[model samples]
Target: MIRIQHLSLMRGTKPLFEDADLTLNPGERIGLIGANGAGKSTLFALLRSELHADGGDVDFPSAWRVAHVAQETPALERSALDYAIDGDATLRRLQVELEEAEAHPDHAAQGHRIGELHAALADADAYTVRSRAETLLTGLGFSQQQMNRPVSSFSGGWRMRLNLAQALMCPSDLLLLDEPTNHLDLDAILWLEDWLKRYPGTLVVISHDRDFLDGVVNVIVHIDDRKLKRYSGNYSSFERQRAAQMVLTQAMIEKQTRERAHLQSFIDRFKAKATKARQAQSRMKALARMEETAPLRAAAEFSFEFREPASAPNPLLVLEAVNAGYRVEDEATGASTERTIVKHINFSLQTGQRIGLLGVNGAGKSTLIKTIATELDPLSGVARFGKGLVIGYFAQHQVEMLRHDESPLWHLAKLAPDVREQDLRNFLGSFNFPGEMATSSIAPFSGGEKARLALALIVWQRPNLLLLDEPTNHLDLETREALTDALAQFDGTLVLVSHDRHLLRATTDTFLIVADGKLMPFDGDLDDYRDWLFKTRLSPAKETQAAATANAAPSAPQVDRREQKRIEAEERQRLSTLKKPIESRIKKLEERMGKLQARKAEIDAKLAEPAIYESANKDELKTLIAEQGACGRELEEVEMAWLEQQEALEQIA
Candidate 1:
């Protein structure tokens, strides 16, 4: 449990929280929500003790462990699995000591110490730790082979996944997760949601993903007016509750409005008269102190109609035996090799048709969408587009492609040189970029703002076909919902690739599964698609492998059924043999971890006392701190070893 009493906090003289009192009870999963820059991150900093409270106190058990994902991961030669397992501070500590003990060539003495260390490793469940880490890695979209890859090999997004896995790797009483689903696809997000629901610790997650919050969080902590308002349920419940409160408040404000107008008229008529000056002044002070309610600024509405295309063409697009993908170039040899991402995709789009693309990550959903958008030519067969076909393409990269030095006004002006400046401003205003914000450079804009600008640019052109790939990546719930509303009303043909289930469900009428290197119509809704994911796809790696085999198999196949079955059985047996030792190793590690964790708890208890820090026991305090630190290093080492075992198991699976 954690307690905050009249707490005040500031970020560079800006008060983020003032006289804020809140309580976080044991095992409560709370969703921290506010507008961006409303100090959600600052609140996390305060909890982490990186910032001191300006007033009052923040109190929690000193022995409680806190875990959060690191924002950056340095490029290193360490394998991804090892990096994740390093989150267990205790496991690493024990492993370090074990390494030293094994190195010292003292025969009987070294043997005894090594045996004792392995026992400690067993206590920590150190053996299965590797398997545990790899499970997290696999769930986050890493393959068995990728787990052994060096950290430096991955891109920024994958590294973020690594960082998240590391945080999840750590055993803690309190878990602080901020936007954990940002880089994840729909499938990964689903897996993570399930994982979080099973977590036993007190969890505080800060995310703009409303559906995710609804799925996992039980409590909503909203930061408003420099105060924390705790709501009893998830995001949807909070919305309904807030809406009801607003209605009641609005009713009272109507009566106050009448009173304010009467007082203002009285003061205006009497202030100039010398006889009424005292009374007017008294009224003025009363006006200042009156419990006034300001009108609620209506929610910023991103409401806009997509200008209908100049001409509607039947069958806007047709893919005839299309093989869509890329020709890869070998960097060193300057040799090109054709790589087919999606094979023989026979997809078509008609006027006003809406299609939602669904598949696991890297299943060529983007490839097929790109081919239809004419961004990439089909490697084989024909892609036919109707007359006057105009495409509005939205990709994840377009937001970063936005010129930081330019204003939203400038972006629109460039797209339409003939349009009047006022017209452009009006259009931008509809996107919620009003007043000075229209002219201001977007260098300081948040990701959601940049995305809106990009979408606004797309809308200005009035394309007949919309190709959106993960357009809601950084949008807040409000903006995403607004986009959903707009797209639902759009009169153009739409092909959208998004991990946001709510947006997909609301905006699309048709679904296509981009799996097995094929484009096939899915005769199901979003809920049906979820069921399909679990039933058809066992894992992301298997899905990709199956697709690759289907696309790359010989044109004339010779293998018989019995031969294939015999091969599969043999391979399964080999993997089973390979996994046995690894599983044994992980089990031993877990047992070792359990013991070390108990010992570490005892050391923490001693360190928690005030007398230990006093001059009377300074030496004892130093000795205890050192012992605690040593235990931490060993635990980390054991966890790393355990991660290797887990990676091996995933490879077999």
Candidate 2:
């Protein structure tokens, strides 16, 4: 268990949390939620002891093991396996001892040393460690070839997987993870959600992924206004409770206001009467003692209005085998090459239809969006916009177009041009920019703020059609919900490419899955499209060797079948006679392994202590090392036997 007491954290002059308390039980999975900069990450960092709070303490059992996965993967050159195995100090020591024993098997005291090494190894389950590492890597979508590859070769997203795999492999008592699903593709995210559901330890995760939170976590802890609120269930349940509480709060505030007004009228009408004056005074005191209602702040508001062009028509844009890609040229050599990222994507945007594009990472979702938005042309095929359909394009990289020196207000005015300065500020304020924030330069804004600014600029024009590419990237929970709500209520047609499941489910009634070298239109939600993708693109056919092996033995002839049936009956009888003995042996091995592991942990704790430095510097150190070495050897032998027995059981099946 972990407890946070009277926690107060201040960033610069702003107090993030004041007198806040939070707790986590042994097996509870908590979803840490809040608006942007509401201390979700700060609270996590404090719990992990990475950041010190202004005042208060984080309490945890001294024996508990904790692991935290940061938002960004560390820049390291280690192999993936090395990175993961380093997470467990005990396991690493065991490996070191085993490797030493293997290297010097023919030494002077070989027999005695090998015996000790075998014991220590078995206790550590060193035999299964490599297999477990491989399983975890494969489960995270990495191929066998990549397990030994240097971590630096992988992209940032894959590096995140390495970080996540490391944290998960550690057998910690508590896990602190922030945005574990941020860079993961849909399949990887789903796999993680499933893994977290079965995780044995306590979990505290700060994430904006709604689907993940709903499926994995059992509780939601919300931090707001420097106060903490705990909910008993998932994000959906939390939202329902919050909305119901808001309604009740509003009703109570209204009732209090009416009563206060009535008391004021009574005081005015009967001030001359002493009895009535005393009664009025009592009413006034009651009103004064009542705590003012803490009204919930309205979530950020977003609305897109597209200005319909009334002029010329012939479709707004057209593409005919118009190949578009960036050319890379070596200035010294004067050599250039064009790499075609996307090709033969034939699509059309009509006057009234909105299209939602779907694809895995690097599946040309952005490229398709760019082509349709007229930022790039298709390699082969015609992409034509309908007549009088003016497009307000919001690319995933639109924030890059902003000038660093220009404030958001100034940027908005420069982009829209037609809107008055006052009107532009009003529009910007809707996306949570107000007062000094509106006047702040684009360089100072966070990623989410920059995204909101880009969105505000696009909508100010109010074109007949709106194209949004990954619009919810870097947004917090509240801002994302607001953006989804706004998109759902938009009157103009919209083409969106996003991994936001909630937004896609709510806004997209149709899906265009880009797979098999083309865009295929489907009429349904993401789940339906996923099912289609699995059958068509994701799944590979069974291996020819496995298929052949499965059919190696053809169905037996009549005489062979009779003989086989007789043999099966005799085997069944023999197995029935031996079942009790086998079961008892398996149970005994498990109990013995458990006791050895307990003893191993005791020895590990003693070896890790600083007492060796103060006393028994050399001889005691060698003895402890030998004892650890013995434990490692035993652990390996026991695990190998267990694996053999398990395999035998499977073979019997």
Candidate 3:
């Protein structure tokens, strides 16, 4: 259990928490939520002991091991797998000690030390550490081949995933995750949800994703009014509870206002008269003694709408046999090469259609959106835009394109130079930029602020078509809700690619799955998409390819039923034939491991007896220790072989 008592914290003179108290019970999955700059991350830093509270008592069990994702991963030449496995500090320490003990010259003196190290390794389950690390990496969307690659080779986003894997690999009693899903796709997010659900530790995550919070957390700790308010149940439950509290608070405020007015009226009427002077004086004292009920300081409300387009044309855009991808350049030859990411795409956008793109990361959802936005021309096909068509595109790069030295007012004015500065400021205010913020330089703004400014610029355009790719990235829950509401009410056609399930479900009426260089309509909703992802993961690559190809072209020639069955049978037989020897090898290894483990246990039991330590039994102790060391080594070798065989079986599938 963790207890925070009279917690008072400050960043400069800004008080984030004043006499705040919270109790976190063991095994409780908590979601820490607050407005931007509300010190959620600061609280995490305090928990990690990276920051000290101004005045507070933060107490937890001293024996507890804490784990958190590192904010920055230094570029290194270490293999991704090795880096992740290093999270198991205990296992690594034991292995290092074992190596040192074995390298000692005197076998008699080192025998006891070697035996102890092996026993510690077995207790830590060190033999399976590699498999555990690999599993974590795989769940975070790393391929087997990629797991062996140098950590420095990955991009920033991928490195973040590696850091997440490393954190999850640690055997921790308390796990702190700050925006763990930011770099993850929907599939990986779903996978993580399951993993965290099964974790036997206390988890506290800070995230802006409502759906993720709803899926993973059982309690919500809201930072509001310089206090930590704990709410029972998930995010939706927290919203309901908070809403009810706000209503009650407002009612109390109104009631107190009426009472104050009544007291003032009585006091003013009689204070000048001698007859009621005593009563008036007493009433004045009562009013002064009354505890004030402060008015509710509501969060800044963010709301905006898309301006109606000048024209709404049927079939706003059309793509025929389009091959959408990037043009790569060979550095040595200085020659550009076209690489199609999404091929044979036949898609159209009509007025008022809301479509969401679904796929794993690197499945070309961005490519399709880019192709439609005209950020990239189709490699080889026709992409026609209707007359009077206007597109409002929002991507991460678009946010980066904002002039850092300019204010929100200036950015809006650039789009509408004829509009008055006040009117433009009003528009920016709707997106939460008011007063000095509208005129101040955005150089020091956070990512969420920049993203909001970019979106504000888009809403001002009133485009007939909206193409948003991961627009919710770096956005808080409030802004995301605002975007969802605005998109829901927008009359223009929309194609959105976001991992935010709540926004997708609320705004998109249809979903298109992008996989295997093909895009096709999914008949079901997000839940079905999740099931499809799991099934696809379990399926063989060739089968997945075949399914994608069949879905892409409805008119493709189909194999006869008998021929298809025959081919499948033959494929199954071949897979089984290849797996037989590996499976046999794995069974033999398991048996060997079991026997060695049993023998080691017997040796341990004998070693625990007092007689084994007697001078007369010194030689017996040495013999037993040597046997124990040999057993541990054989067991480790057998486990590795078993893991290899399992991988081979997976490859055959």
Candidate 4:
């Protein structure tokens, strides 16, 4: 539906595209991938006709509708549903005409106008538009009630989603999205991916989400050094193809370099020979005609050596009866209260298992991860670190802590202490910070750059236990895959909170979910979780959207002394009602932990018997050891719950 012919685009002095040609056909899902500022978004703009190319033609089919969703949204006062439903202005206008025609048949132009209005309304499917609009809105996470709420009340992230809904609902033959998944939580992102996959039209999306790209897109278009390269499959396939291509390209360059060197050496020796003068001259011309092959940029590989610190074999982390949350008070009445975000989450980890933590945003996933990593005492429970375990944390906010005065090179020098200069550059280059980019101070680095640098730092540390929260944010598909591969190879225990479905599935075998103020297990793939969400949360008979958003409820308003007392009394009564269930869950988790611990101890004793390893009946020992290890990990998880439970019990007391 859209094509770029001999297109060239420039931003200031830099040429982003040079005689680059590309095409997007109906129903094609194309993922635009490249380094930052490599003109991925610029190319989208040119295709959408929002930006003019410096040269060449952008051929688009006649009457083709195009829609673009930008990174930032504008001010909108309409409700999210209204904003989405208004995707088709022509349809809306047609509806208005029909309404006018129905109400004012006696007007001067009634007969002719009514005929035209009838045609427009029929063409627009005006009768079924409301139901269609509701489906689009609700699928995009807006509740039925939210259809009338002011969009201005929603945060920028939600506004972006509303904008996306608008784009999707439009009469577009092709859709262009720039970093569309940046602000979405995992659930909303999965919803969009599914929508796009089943969408009848074409889509070209720019996203840092690797899983989304792999799941929805069938083609990959990479823009690099003013050229467009196409791959035939998803991101993972594209990666393998790219690697193979790079190898072939490097070999071609190497062969050409060798031939040129040999020719030059011969020319150098035979320049004055009368018999070889003609040959030397011809070789010189050939050398002049040979196009200079581009050198392969080095990949970033952390070359720093690390020594795993000596640590005990006990659980690397422990949480006992923890209560997590914040303090809240009714301002009007000055009635203070402690709000529990989640209570009675207990877990412990040894040196081997990789655990994935999953939850919807605001479900207290980060709070639990942070409380463990930073060694903060649980609001009511105890958290203890195992003996000698060296912890490395990569929080979402960790990138902001980099010192401004230091360049990527200097940061590596200080952090790794002994990394060679060339090795440091190569490492930074792999993360796409090649050459001078590595020397630039961290102060001016973009969000993606900071994230890459933080990842490099964490990888370089090689700690025995790594705690990573959203480490895949701002990463390209290739880098995220690389990280997953590296993590799979890592011997250390990993506890990570991530929204990247690909990363979670690749690196972790166990899942812990935080929801409803409790810890639960999710024994399925990311797609399975998504399916469950739509079934449970977005079922046809689900509550209206507006009701749900409103139910999150605003804090109590200001009140006089008597009102304050009344509010306090109500809060106390509500807490009393909730206290029983919270207490019950804590007790159950603790009881489970005790039983697992007993099983673990009995297996451990059997494994330690002198003849266990040498016995001809040795298979029994292997099974016992495996069972003991499994029981040990389960016990740790239970302890984490026990801690959370104890905290909840104290709060109720």
Which candidate gets the maximum TM-score versus the true structure?
Answer: 3
Give all candidates' CA lDDT scores.
0.83, 0.71, 0.85, 0.74
lDDT of 4 at 147: 72
Instruction: Tell me each candidate's TM-score.
Output: 0.78, 0.71, 0.81, 0.71
Which sections of candidate 1 miss by over 4 Å? Answer: 110-116, 258-290, 293-301, 536-653
Candidate 3 per-residue lDDT, tens place, 208-259, comes to 9999988777789999889898986679757855765566566666667777
- What is the TM-score of candidate 3? 0.81
Error of 2 at 396 (Å): 3.6
Residues 136-252, candidate 2, lDDT per residue (tens digit)? 665566665688888888887688888888888887889988888766656556557657777888999988878778767777998877977887556875776576556555655
In model 3, the Cα lDDT at residue 90 comes to 85
Local accuracy of candidate 4 as per-residue lDDT tens digits, 1-653: 66778888889999999999887777888999887788988887777778998898888787778887745666777666667768877888887877787689487668788788878778877777667777766666676667777888777767887888778777778888887776666766776776777776788888878778877787899887788887765676567556655665565676678868978998899979999999999989988898977864434443222235455456887777888776677989998677677798777787788898877666787777777876444778888887777777888667768887789888888886776899888877876778998999888887767877887877666678888888876666656767787788777888888878878888898888887788778776665566556654544445555355557658744338577556645755676587778778866875675466556556655554446778795898888978977887886676556545544543441
List candidate 3 segments past 4 Å from native: 272-275, 417-422, 538-653
Q: After superposition, how far is residue 455 of candidate 3 from its true place, in Å?
A: 0.3
Candidate 4 CA-lDDT value: 0.74
Predicted candidate 2, C-alpha RMSD = 18.1
Native-structure RMSD, model 1? 16.3
Cα lDDT, model 4, residue 549: 53
Q: Model 3, 40: alpha-carbon shift in Å?
A: 0.8
Q: What is the Cα-based TM-score of model 4?
A: 0.71
